[model samples]
Target: MTLKAGSILTGTIVNITNFGAFVEVDGKTGLVHISEVADSFVKDIHDHLKEKDKVKVKVLSVDDNGKISLSIKQAIDHKKSVKPIEIDWEKKNTQNAVNFEDKLSRFLKDSEEKFQDLKRHQDSRTRGYKKNTSH
Candidate 1:
């Protein structure tokens, strides 16, 4: 298959370095950068990949010099997109009905209490200032 940007391809990791991994796909070698290895932070490339390991990679770009940039994380994300998300509408609606009211009530109560406390503090300060000024 012709490799192009956004193409997902299975490749063998022929070499690994501190910066990235070299993957051989369709007889062409491409670089999968460290940041593209996984969704999470990669402190060490060796922890995520090894030489000769097969991995699915997404073509990010092919420069004029024939350098291809690949991403393993994008390839994995693309595969995940194939699966449909299942939602329990009944359960979700029930939970939202109950939880939203409770959460809103609690938030309102807390806000009111804070407002009252701030008002009381300001009032006391004002009264104290008036008394000093009068004397």
Candidate 2:
């Protein structure tokens, strides 16, 4: 079969090196660079790959020289439909819930009471020091 870019192919590791690994696909050879061995850092290419190991690889490129570049990490499919975590903010059925409207009303009432107290204190302080009313 003809190898093409962005195509996934099954291949066997023919050789391993410190910098990369060579794979044989459809009787044609390809090189899987150490950086393409995985999505993470690869300190030693041999630790992640070995000779004669069958692996699925994604075709990165095929140059004019017919030398194919492959990626083992990109071959596997990672597309999964995932939903965000849904949270119940309020217990509508429960009687113990503090509703938004109720909370707002309570806050307004408390603010009014505090304002009245502050006004009373200011009035009391002013009462001690009377202002001249005669023009």
Top candidate by lDDT:
1
At residue 76, give the lDDT of candidate 2: 71
lDDT for each candidate structure: 0.93, 0.90
Per-residue alpha-carbon lDDT of candidate 2 for residues 1-135, written as tens digits (9 for 90 to 100)? 788998998999999988899999999999999999987899998788889999999999999999999999898775643356798877465543557668889999999999999999999999889789999
Writing each residue's lDDT as its tens digit, candidate 1 over 76-135 gives 865656687898766557777789999999999999999999999999889856445654
How far out, in Å, is residue 12 in model 2?
0.7
Error of 2 at 131 (Å): 9.2
TM-score of each: 0.61, 0.61
